[model samples]
Target: MANVENRGNGSYRLTVILGYDEKGTPIRERKTVKAKNMKEAKKLLTLFEAEILTGEYFKAEDKMTLNNFFPQWLEKHAKDTLSPDTLQNYISILQKRILPKYGHFKLEDIKTIHVVNFINDLKKNGQRLDGKDGKLSASSVLNCYKAFNNVLSCAYRWKLIKENPAIGAKPPNGKAKKSEVYSKEELSQLMQLLDDKPLFWKTLILLAISTGAREGEIAGLEWKHVDFEKGTIRIEQAITEIKGKGVQIKGTKTGKERTVSVPEKLLEMLKKMELTSRQDKWKVRDLWEWPDHFFIFGNEFGKPIRPDSIGQWWRRFTKKNDFKHIRFHDLRHTSATLLINEGVHAKVISERLGHADISTTMNIYGHVLEEADKTAASHFELFFKKMN
Candidate 1:
């Protein structure tokens, strides 16, 4: 039998008798449970009592604290499963934000209220780790919340915790800023400035805008993946920087290979690179035995260039040339937006962008589609003019 007593601070203390000790003295245990109301308190008390009766209750030694379990979770659950970038974020939150606050607390001790309070605190502080001085955006906080909630959800699914408290916690909703893209006029001006630029720079930017491929995908490209006859580039892998491992080639973002069509002009440009490549290959042949498959966007040393280096170059180029500024990723949006304006079918655009679903393409480029919708409606004006 168990007894529940109000702790007078919106909490209930559950008292239960386990058994008699060797001295015939009754063994007693008590847990202070936090709940929204008496009904929840009663339910928790009942559940705890049932677990004890069935010998399924976790002993003190068996119970894991948030700090202890996180490392185990990282090793067993996250290591091989999540992308290096994503796994790094999980580890960061566990060490910096989450573990610092809840490390000493057991998994079962954390409740919906605790999770909700943690989010509230994050919203209140809103600090960023990247050294940017601005307050953290709601969307950024929401991302952190998602990482924290995912761990709890995993524990719940593994039966380490009785319930996933995060499910009951409020999700952080934030205003989404539209992606900024270069206008067609701006894009044309930028192209003119690139006339004397290196072929790698020109080709990388052009491919990004034409194919809507990520920077990693562009940098990961090898000559073998590019088919001059087929006029297509197979995106099989991408090089990315992981936390501990530094830079390594990995699968595409979606973990699936996708083929993107190339314009004949772009294909011709690539074919011309082989002539320049052969001239450069002699310079490095004696120094190092480079990989047989050379990256299309390799450095002078016949090694793949890091995505960050390209971004840095873009920033410097835009500043020096006085060009309209946009992040490299915005080039992807430019491609999708231009396709929408040209009345390209959504499915075709989605496939070209290697989006898993048409909705993703539509959602990101919806503003352009809305304008196209108006253009579509205005087409009926010619028919109505005859009636007038």
Candidate 2:
């Protein structure tokens, strides 16, 4: 049985009595709630009593603040499940945004309104941590929302809360940025410029444009991965740098290995690069550090070139050559765009880019596909006119 007693203003005390304890004393549960009137108090009393009966009621002493629970969640769940980079990003979001605002709040006390307000605050006033004047980017806000939602979801799964407030909160709408790519004429001009550059830069840039591979993937390429006879390169690994950890070799971004075909001319360049590497190896025989590794893009001592160095070099090259500026990654977009313009099947393009699915390819290049469709219609119309 449950009872509610008005305690002045909008406050009411609710109490429920179970049978008897071992000493024949009444076992009681009590809670204080706020309501506008007797009717609301009685409704609250009913709900509280139901929660107790169903063993869903949380005791005050059992409540844990977000501050106290985050470390436990990180150790017990995040560490084992999330990748290092993803874990780091989540930690940054929690510490920078979520914890400062809500860490002191008990899991059960965090309401839907609180999460909604937080999201709104981020959209309206969240500033960049980099000391810039602008507000946080929409993508950054979305990351904060995702990380907070993930934390609350874990708390709900742990039975620390009756419901996840974040579940009801809407995130900011951040659209994916359009990719920049060189046109066919621009690509041809770039290739002509590469001919006079050092062999290393020429091969690397050409490989990037041909394979549509990531810079890290190109950095991680080994001599053994190239099959000259077949004119194919196996892309199974990438070199990545972690903050405070320096460089490391890791599986590809999607954790899937792919083989990409290359132009025969690029293979010949690779062979020349290989000969150069062997000659350099003979010169630095005792100084060579990674004799067993044999990376295609190794330095004078046979260590793979740092992945960031490739981008740094690209910035310098583009600046020195007075070329229209685009990111080294844009070269990959250039490759995919060129292929699409050449009427390559979307599935084949998807596979070449190591995308997880054809839908991903279609989504990223949908505009280009639409343009191609228009061109195809124009060609058909011209053919009919010519025949007539």
Candidate 3:
């Protein structure tokens, strides 16, 4: 219950009498308000009344710590919306990083100062459970911070705290910048490095570079989704890694289907691949062995290949060639960077990449596009020496 009373000195007081704390002790809190007169005091009382009615009034029971509610919060709110991959990340951070630091404490026990100190602790912890140096990367710690903030945001929405303690905390400054794109010569060397790999995996790499499809999307490719006649490939599913299983097919990242145009060379390559695949039908018969079903890139025996398998294959190929260290994802970046460098617009690149946002495409490829302009100008300046 809440009530406001005039104190007769141009001031008013609002008091909330809570039912009881967890241990059955009565809890109460009060706030003072300055008012011109009884009329203003009455207005303030109305505001307090509204707040109390909506359960926004902070009673003593509301002062319980965040740790107590974390489990309930996860069970009730986060379980369904979070993807399996994302859920794993959250649990890993909570168990390894967050719980040991702040698990025993309540929400009110946490302060902005605690958040700042925790980030510093992450930087200096210097030892992990694996007995390896635990010097946390700036980007990883930033993600932890984001995860913490998201938890607190839920707390705020649930009215667990008066304000979010994790709000406004600065993210760690990243020490590493992303690397430059591969040059044509380097790209040629890398592709040549792939000559000895499985034909299907090689085709996967080639398609990734040419179409700028994500690794998972490429792994999920099915023949039905490909239109060799129109030279187009449609993105509808993704092959993702599951804990118990090697890989599982899931919905696309945006949950929307999109089509990308392939070049004539790629269409011809697919035709040759279809012929080659038909000749070797006994390889992946145990898995994905449906009759009349066609997979653009599948195991030798006709089963769908997992994304992890493709990633592992790519790693071996790169290591064997002693090529520059870059993730398979960089292949997508290489495609976009190459296209932008050759004067392709970001909009077209975004469409090919199946990005949900044009801004994302622009943000990534904008600098590469600018660099291309500089290179073109330099070449023109040297070539036309006597231009009037």
Ranking of predictions according to lDDT: 2, 1, 3
Candidate 1: segments with Cα more than 4 A from true spot: 1-49, 52-56, 286-292
TM-score for model 3? 0.78
lDDT of 1 by residue, 1-388 (tens): 6888888778999878888999998897778889888888999999889887865566677788888888778888888888877888778877888888988999999999998998888776436777766667888778778878888988877777878899999898865678888888988898899878988788888889899999888888888898888899998898897766666788888877888888987887888886687677777886533466578887666777788887899999999998888888888989998888889999999888878788987787777899998998888887788889
Number of the predicted model whose lDDT against the real structure is largest: 2
Please rank every candidate by TM-score, starting with the best. 1, 2, 3
- Residues 239-320, candidate 3: write the lDDT tens digits: 7776765566777876767899888877877888888776666555555464555567776655677676767877787787
For candidate 2, the clash count comes to 0
Q: How does candidate 2 score on lDDT?
A: 0.89
Instruction: Give the CA lDDT, 0 to 100, for residue 58 in model 1.
Output: 67
For residue 210, model 3's alpha carbon misses the true position, in angstroms, by 1.0
Cα RMSD of all models vs. native, in order, equals: 5.8, 4.1, 6.3
